[model samples]
Target: MKGIQSTGPALLMLAILILAPAFAEPAPNTIKIVCTTSVLMDPATYIGGDRVEAITIADPTLCPHLQGDIIPSRIQLNMDFIPGADLFMAYNDSNDQRYNIPAVNDFMKANNYGSVTWKTVSDPSREWNTPAKAKLLAEEVRGWLVQYDPINESYYDERYGEYVKSFDAIEPTPAEKEKLNQTQVIVMLWQREPVEEWLGMNVVNIFAPEFALNGTRTAAKVVDDINANPEKYRNVSFIIENMQSGELAKGIEESLKDKGINVKRVVFTNFPRSIEGVDTMAEVLEHNKQIVL
Candidate 1:
């Protein structure tokens, strides 16, 4: 009887041990991805599928480039999360949307957590703001996921195919392409340069904001250019603005319409419109297409 009682408890304990993992959250062997910016997290989530746990150094609520401005408190919080990451992906838009990672690296060093070798992407042929670039980056992300978790290679590729197809629908239609081909545009901000190529529009000039020109005579002289040669800027059907640089639009609106230029003054967000939306790249790109077209 004592043998039976002892064995009964042991068997029960054994059963509990075996069942514990079945009810556990997040299965073992899941890849941990740490993205330098939240904008990159969208694509990483899609490509990682359910096998990845993604952490973004930059949160979705902030602007893309502003990710570098995360406060000291947030940095300490990240110290708890980043040490376990298996892969680190960083975007290298040194000209337009640079990210600062030295602080993150230093934290890892202080905590004795090894610093991950970062994989970077600088889209030299096309900028990251457009759908085409998003599609290209998705492929790169898929490759990274596959490299780390080769067992789920097929799964990642399947998700990537769907992601690419979704963006394919966002491309300009034939008629829209023809219209864009004929129209010339002047974007007031340097960050908006990709819109010109993405929409097939001729970008005559991309004006960089000289902060010194705020309410200065130089600003007036530039405004005079739009007023004096309305015909020269007639084909300028879109005065696309950066969401970050609303000041550039200050006095240009009246001059742009001196000849009834009828331009669509559009604003573009550098980051995903909604971070929680799993298909953020598709949603943001499609939103831009609907507005621009």
Candidate 2:
């Protein structure tokens, strides 16, 4: 997966100069952005408005873990799009060990073109619990949104402040707070490494199929929790970092059903893309709220 380094700064400057007019006219304001997956691309699109030019690498339904064959068309697309990109976003973490990230990283390094940033959508602190990890990852995304769209800093700060206040308001009502806490979820991750931190250093709730497909005691506990009371826990969620097909999702659903528990809500959080949009952080937060709530 080795990649050649990008054209040096002089060539990059030359390329930028050549592309500057194209951008200055009407399209440059629309920053070209590339995402590793569609889950990330969609939300970015909502926030970017018309200013971003985005490209997604992994389709929503493909398994990123198994994406070994890099299409020539995609490579050519990246060559064409990345040179003109204002920002490049990628999910670089231990969990992506299965993907061809080295090649991707090499390409970005060689280009030295855009403001590249890495996002670990999964919580690295926690082991395998999906609910707590998803919440943490959501918070991380808020920060990324702020960084990506700094023009709306004040608005994003205010909206985030209000969101926190709303969460606090619910705390005063014990019954309501309990209800929020009872919103149990189960995340079926594509891998277990990246989310270790999000699950907390001490917490360990996942079981890899390679080691023991059925899961360990910690995972069993979560399964028990879901089985203990499914009615009370209406919102069960899972964040699949690695790309998975609809059939895999169905398999997870059926597995839960076998335990007399069914998943109520599901959200896809990762994807691939080419363009970058320019929207406020507030907008991104609002979109996340809609997906989760």
Return the TM-score for each candidate structure: 0.76, 0.44
Residue by residue across 152-261, what tens digits does model 1's lDDT show? 78989998898788878777889988977787776655445556667777875555456523634233555777766667787777666666444465456567776677
Candidate 1 clash pair list: none
The lDDT, on a scale of 0 to 1, for candidate 1 is: 0.68
lDDT tens digits by residue: candidate 2, 1-293: 12334556667889999998877845336656666655445445544545556776654445555455753345556687755665555555442434534555667677675434555555443432233333343355456667877876565555445533433332224553344344444444434432233221111233223233444523444456546755543444442223242323344445467665555434433232211331322232233223333
lDDT of each: 0.68, 0.46
Q: Give the 10-residue window scoring lowest on summed lDDT in candidate 2.
A: 198-207
Candidate 2 stretches with Cα past 4 Å from truth are 1-28, 71-73, 95-100, 108-149, 152-293
Best TM-score among the predictions, by candidate number: 1
Compare the candidates by lDDT and give the number of the best one: 1
lDDT of 2: 0.46
